[model samples]
Target chain A: MSVSVAQTALLDKEPQFRHAIPTRDGRTARNRARYTFTVLAFLLPSAIPLLLFVLGPMVAAAWVSLHKWNLLAPMQWVGLGNYAKLLTDPITGDVFVHTIYYIAGYLPLVYFGGLALALALNTALKGRSILRGIYFLPVVTSWIVVALVWRWLLSPTSGIVNTVLAAVGIHGPGWWTDPHWAMPAIIVASSWKDLGFVMVILLAGLQAIPTELYDASKVDGAGWWRRLFSVTLPLLSPSTFFVIVISLINGFQVFDQVYAMTGGGPNGASEVVVQQIYDLTFRYGRAGEASALSWMLFAVVLAVTVIQVRGQRRWVTYG
Target chain B: MAEALLTARTPARRTVGRAPRSREAKLRLAGVIVLHLVIIVGAIAMFFPFLWTIITSITPGASLTTTPALIPKNPSLGAYQRLFVERPFGQVILNSFLLAVITTAVQLVTSSTAAYAFSRLPFRGQNVVFGVYLATMMIPLQVLIVPLFVELKAFGLLDTYLGALLPTFATAFGIFLLRQAINQVPRELDEAATIDGAGHFRIFTGIILPNIRPAIATLVVFAFMGSWNSFLWPLVVLRSPELQTLPIALAGLQGQYTSQWDVIMAGSVVSVLPMLALYVFAQKYVIQGVASSGIK
Candidate 1:
């Protein structure tokens, strides 16, 4: 009876009729067979590499996570111990807090600073394209290169930043050495590297707004300040949403900059979760602990994704 | 006569409003100029380090610390010479170059095909399969590092080129993006090919590939950059310094600290120059790819 009701409900929407297999002529059947072979051949080239590297590794990781083992050691039957140990680590907890601080610092510099810069560029002017390219130059360059550049800039006594500050009658702290300043300096550098991308995304959002909306506002005696509040802010929210989502994701995965600039140094003040995990695994040779930490990071990112995906439905407009 | 004087006075007063209007326009112009100046200056603020790296790299080592000139007062190739002469720099560059090329080629071929299959083909459980594929994009490598390392060991592929290349063979974003790219290829073309005697493979290779060169080019540049600059996996798997990629070796330059600035900067310049050149040449494709990804 339940099956009948389910079938009736499905059919009420529109029953999907299954078509019989076509009895094609020799030529058509040959063509179909050829098409099948073509797709299979095309797919094989792409699928094989992924199957070996990504899919296989994923399953293997889960299996390994269940057992306690390290390199040069036999597997111990510690089913949930690896998982439990990650939750209890004091250092991992500290890293998690700093990671949140990093995000807090990262958001304002990029989201707000990027939007403001993008808006400034969207103005009608000569040499705008040239300016855009200069801003975006870092986006294309690898973070490894950017990190190297900032390492020099953030070098405290000999660095240009401090030198310039000294010229202005202000003393600058040793940025890379000062634990309090390390993460912030790293944030400043990451923000610089990231501005080009944020600028572009925001530029796209700005361009998409209809000129008519602005014109209408102007006709109704709205000034630049008034029009921005009424029209631009609402329209720009979707782009803002996209930026925040990815920015949050990036905040979670910020390793290269921290790894390159500070190496989680000045006594682990700049240490992010990923770098902490790297240290445990590669530095300390604690594979299980690192893996456990990784799972913790993964869980955090997962929760954030769930919230953003759900939140997007309410605020993100397709256009 | 009295009314006419009053009208003239009113018209004269209206001209005062016009005077302030011109003044307001001047003020607006001044404000815009100041804003642009600030933005431009800020943009330059971030690039000072890069500028210094390039300048210092050209400077002779003796003057590097003694004089630290912006224009590299006595510019020389001495550091570049040391980078190559004192180390396996050439081999490392070749390793990075070859690894980047092969990885990109493998990724493009594999990703485009899987994308096409997932996009164009009507297979059994297609959505489910593709969902599984998309899910992999978020599985951070750190989580799987231990298992992958163990697996590579079992396969006896540690420190091998294949081991370096294996993990990135399939990128979820590549497939997703390429599928977005290939979906724009009209289904009518495939149907027409079917109408002809051409097999599926012939149609795909001959018809599809020729059309989607831009997307493929975009993928090639992106893949090249990703593999060339990779750090963690290379650091972990490759125990031999000779087998290390440029990034790994360059990162190792960090241990030398203050003494290694010029050499490290030289290495940084070496690691990035090829990519910068490639980007300059194929910038049209790269920019379009970057811009389109914004909308996505």
Candidate 2:
């Protein structure tokens, strides 16, 4: 798990107080039983649902991935058959590539844009709080609403973006309607929505950097650019790494925006992995194959996350 | 002030340092202005789509092809009326509201109890069980939706609100967040209560819950927003129009009325306003929560 610095700090703190129970006489055994029962009672509310819904479903997914079954049909044992089929399926590869394309475009744009916002707002500027609120509005808005608004904003003929571009004597690309542009359109909305989230995280990181470091650098004749490079970014690397890992994980599951905007249409140029899983099960009645592909995605996500966690030690400076 | 004092002390270097210091102040002022300009521009770009949505929703007879006027000549509330009168939007919104409230309430109870267990109660293999819960956080709901759907059907919960709400009753993120909050409460308070013959239940309610109110508020806002905005499970489970939540309803509206920008944007406004309102009121908690957790 690529735990963020903030989360790890919380988790690593030692328990502050421990119960001191006397081990005299036969009361100790009764007290232990009573303590166990009380603990179980406290945990029961969440434990039942977690077991039935989350953990059980995970095990079931793996089991179903090994069998062939539809919603209304008897299960046919097909051990590893779905995996083999999906491995050869070209759509699976295409969806993975398209998902990668989304991450490739989205990660850099959102990260840098958010970094700029964080840096700008980290100053003691007036109305910075209001500005933060404005930037974060889209983050709270649902993806469906965002996609619809962007679909209108990026409408090929009379949308605001194209209208503005045409005023500048540049013809705008057919954004959601064009095959080559669909993913980019989705990427734009996705990045716009997430910039504030990244900004919030990075801004916290920037605020955590000690002012003494900047003062020390200033005394050393470090200019603005030098201070930014030498002082700000290296210290901001943990939050940066946290943001990237999260964005990459989320980018692979990009579905709602694509589902609303293009429906993976215009020659299926924008079909991503999660949407593929959705379509395979819901639209095509291929539950087993969908489960297989989901497992593949799980593997990819796990591998990527683990690699990032391991790789963070190389670049992520703690302080 | 320090620079001024230093330059004043050395007469020979006074003129040399004073000139650059003035220029440096001017440069700093210019930098601040530039920074504000860039940030303002970015803020406008971020807010423009929302502004456009509101504008298009009000402009009568608006369609996607019509270039939206920043200030409508004669705005009308007919689109909102159409949303309620022509569509079952009233019922849909109510459904979403009810679901969000119920989900938030249930999650708060479940998560707080579980957090109380993890933080205060020592048990065998406690770390291992907690680790398992944390590990589940990394698994996306997409991986479980298929089996979850099948399980719901077996339980005869498909196409019901329970189906949509069941899997969400317990969240690892909520438990983790609340656990952190509970750990911050002074243990002496718990010990004092225990010494006074207070049991775990009373201590949880009287001491822990009251102290962790901020975390509860944060979780409430997030849980409400999450349930309100959740799409995949609701879409898969709730098939009836009468039971549609906001996101599912809006998606259906988009699919059904592909070109009706006014009605669709009106729906967008209705859906977004509650969240923005909640955010406006609790912006600090929301931002701090996201900053700490990096999840939303």
Candidate 3:
């Protein structure tokens, strides 16, 4: 009986195969050539710009990293000199350390804050959409605007934050000015701006989860916390992993806010790698060192991303 | 079926235990109230900075006083009027808008064509090419700024609007996004079009483009926002005050008028308004785009 059934299946598929083969075979060499040409034509426009702006610059940047050349001066080769400076220079080491501190403070706040917001909005609550829009407002606003406004609000003496603190009979720390509080202030502001983005991504993750799992967990006598841990978190790990990688990459390139708000200020207390690169190239006219710094940053980002990609296998679950 | 089971179990459970049900309902009500209260506080915190900026911008003689007023006692548009008159605020806005618009348009064209080839047209080493393209996304614009600037100088395109615009024209993110969208278009449609003697361009322009309008819109929003908020590259390239974009100008204004809180606040408001309007209108596309790209 099984042999007869297999025979019937093959017999049924034979005619369809006969019908499909001729059509595919009918295309001549000229037609194939034309099709190939069409693909090339379609690809060329994007490829040129990508090569010139992105690909070419990448190679050129690598070349520049090995040489000492100001805009006016002729190039002088300095193999590994800039990279050596990255190790020996105290400011570079300090900036790299500050960046790690920033990531330490920033990553958790953004992930947790974003996840908390997403959970709050995920319920069948009234006006949830409006609340979402309110949270998302800062994400769309320009960094310059965000940084400037935050600077005003965190002003050491007369800012609203300090005013509120004084009203509670507590002295507010000098936020952007004080060395101790500067990184924290920046971390808070940066997290606030980015919270909406992470929240939205996680919300998407949350919404994609089927309701049956929650119902099943509830039927199994699981309470809210148990259900969240067992069902939601396991399922949401993919998005969480995404948020971690993106936030980490962005954390390394933390320039705009620092540039606009702190200028790596108060004796380089809030300095980050990108800001250092900016200063090295423009302020100090050390183009080669700056390029090397940029490459170092790129390598760090690449390494982190590779680690995340490899690490996700241990935690992230996809259904 | 599961929902039906839940409903059945809920009703039966409630009927068997009235007192417990009432207590549960009460607890749920209280929990909801607390949740809403927390969300409201968060909302206020999120909106407060913009509110303070607007208030400061409107308040005459707004300054760094011990007590910052939440509401302006005497609001005026004087700061706004002075902003445009005292600085090239209008010119800056124009430059930003022009660059953003041009960049968005060019990226859409380049990204769509490339995305189409990647998604529909199978060729040699397609995966390698795409992998290279995606890898470019990992390289932040900051890494390329120095060399890109030098290259532009070599081409004698430095300080031109074209210089500010060129680096933005082709984005790996845009291509990746558009390719994702194009992949969703069924291959059957392309085959059908090919059977009718329609070429690759015809199908891309007619069928695929129409089907992927949402992706196009998403790319448009991303590209526009990127150019609008772009600071580091534009700062490095455009040295002249006349060629300065909005964010660059705002930073410059803050530097020149460090003590003029009102004027700086006004500049912040002006710089933020266009983006605010865009977000308000295109919130769905923006969120959807971020969500889709973010996850995969």
Candidate 4:
């Protein structure tokens, strides 16, 4: 019996197959426990950690949203005060507005920048690999560093960007200081750092396209612009859709760049929701409001992602 | 096939007729050159910040962040010295490195197995479980800050290393990536291992681990990079000066008006150097992962 059992195990060693037996038997009961235990092996250390650290914190923030709690004081049951404050509070409104403005400029710059870069490099050219390294450098560089360099570059008087502009007899705005240009400058800086990332995604989409399609188009006497419009654009939608979904999610959570570049400053024209949450929770110890704001962002991101995913099925082409 | 290939691309290669070597050939060459040059220049524009950081870190305080000091007037290790003497900058680096290593190690192990289960093995609520995992990715991490803080307080994990790594240790992205990678791995490999009477754990650890080495490396570098670059989570979790990670410490430093530019640059260099080295080593995989992982 032992030999036969061992041989049977050897015959079908896959875990899923081993557990695919249909029965009301004792062996099946034991297999159930073993399967559950095996599943827990993966969950115990990894998923649970995120569940605790990432997911748990999100849920706690929501719970805190219902209260009037701060770091200094005990939680007070001021149910829904934080959420209510979100609608009526002028400061919250300002932060929300600035967050959208930053997104408005930053997203287009990054998305288009990535797409153009991907297209430019798609041709069979010498040193394409080297071009990739150069393009992707900023995506890996720390935000602290990018922000620092930009801080210098955008410095009004002696900064290189303005210095170059002055050469053309046009003065660049005091980027970090002027309320009008502070957020825009931050967007430009952020876009510079993020362009490579988008390029890589769009590039992957570019590479995934079939060479035969291009040949077929060429056979039919299609030109560069025509080939791009009919073949490349349609085929590249999946990658672009993926990039858009991610960039938008990341757009809502813009913090480090803003923290380093603008400090949400020059009359708070760049104050984002995450920055606001950071101030409320860390600076002011207002955990409730921070959690409330976080929940709001989560909802917005969730809805956006779902809508995008559903919308993607109709438009995005996959091979 | 090999012997025949040695004689290929002979007279038969010319069947397409004389290639257009007129205006079109020259035009194509010119276009490629101009296009590639634009990409190269844009690449420089993006990467200039990293070079600037490295250069500035070694420079002294003179003409830093002022006067078009593109190059230091007199470069010095003066910033490095100031970094250590001025504050607990070394502690911040140590904390970030230590936390990143620990978090990444746990995430890799857990995410791999879970991903294996999702991709290879069927269980109750399998689809639902996977959906739940993907669905959770959209939940703004900031949402759980309040609850996690409270939970940490209950366990006295707040302001501790474990607290910092706990929430990030099991990540959805890790699972998602591992699942995709594992799914691509031939099921025959698993079947062969299992047919040898190996238990599920043994099969995964033995056959799966060895085969998925490249995928694992990809995950490791990414997990390390993300955790290392993580700021907001550590900021919310740890408040003590000695406990803060690199970004948190840098933020604290910059939060105070009149931040010493030299020392901050030094700290920034410290935070970025390890990842830079890792990138230099695994440039291909890291770059690919960064570009693709934008799915958030």
lDDT of each: 0.68, 0.77, 0.76, 0.69
Q: Which lDDT tens digits does candidate 4 get at residues A114-153?
A: 8877776554445655666667667667776687678888
- lDDT minimum window of 10 residues, candidate 3 chain B: B1-10
TM-score of each candidate structure, all chains considered together:
0.71, 0.75, 0.76, 0.75
- Point out the worst 10-residue segment of candidate 3 chain A by lDDT: A13-22
Q: Considering only N, C-alpha and C atoms within 3 Å, which residue pairs clash in candidate 2?
A: none
For candidate 4, what is the lDDT?
0.69
Candidate 3: clashing pairs of residues = none
* TM-score of decoy 4: 0.75
DockQ of each: 0.22, 0.30, 0.32, 0.31
Better of 1 and 3 by lDDT: 3
lDDT for model 2 comes to: 0.77
Q: Write the per-residue lDDT of candidate 3 for residues B3-120, one digit (tens) a residue.
A: 2222322323344555545765556545656766878999999987778778888987777553467778888999899889988899989999999999999999999999888877
Best by DockQ: 3
Which 10 consecutive residues of model 1 chain B have the lowest summed lDDT?
Answer: B1-10
* TM-score ranking, high to low: 3, 2, 4, 1
Model 2, C-alpha of B265: deviation from truth (Å): 1.3
User: Deviation in angstroms for A257 in model 4?
Assistant: 2.2
Off by over 4 Å in 1: A1-48, A112-133, A136-174, A197-246, A315-319, B1-36, B62-67, B85-91, B109-143, B156-159, B176-220, B235-244, B252-258, B285-296
Docking class of 2: acceptable
Question: For each of the candidates, what fraction of the native contacts does it recover?
Answer: 0.32, 0.41, 0.37, 0.40
Pick the lDDT winner: 2
- The chain A TM-scores for the candidates, taken one by one, are 0.78, 0.82, 0.82, 0.82
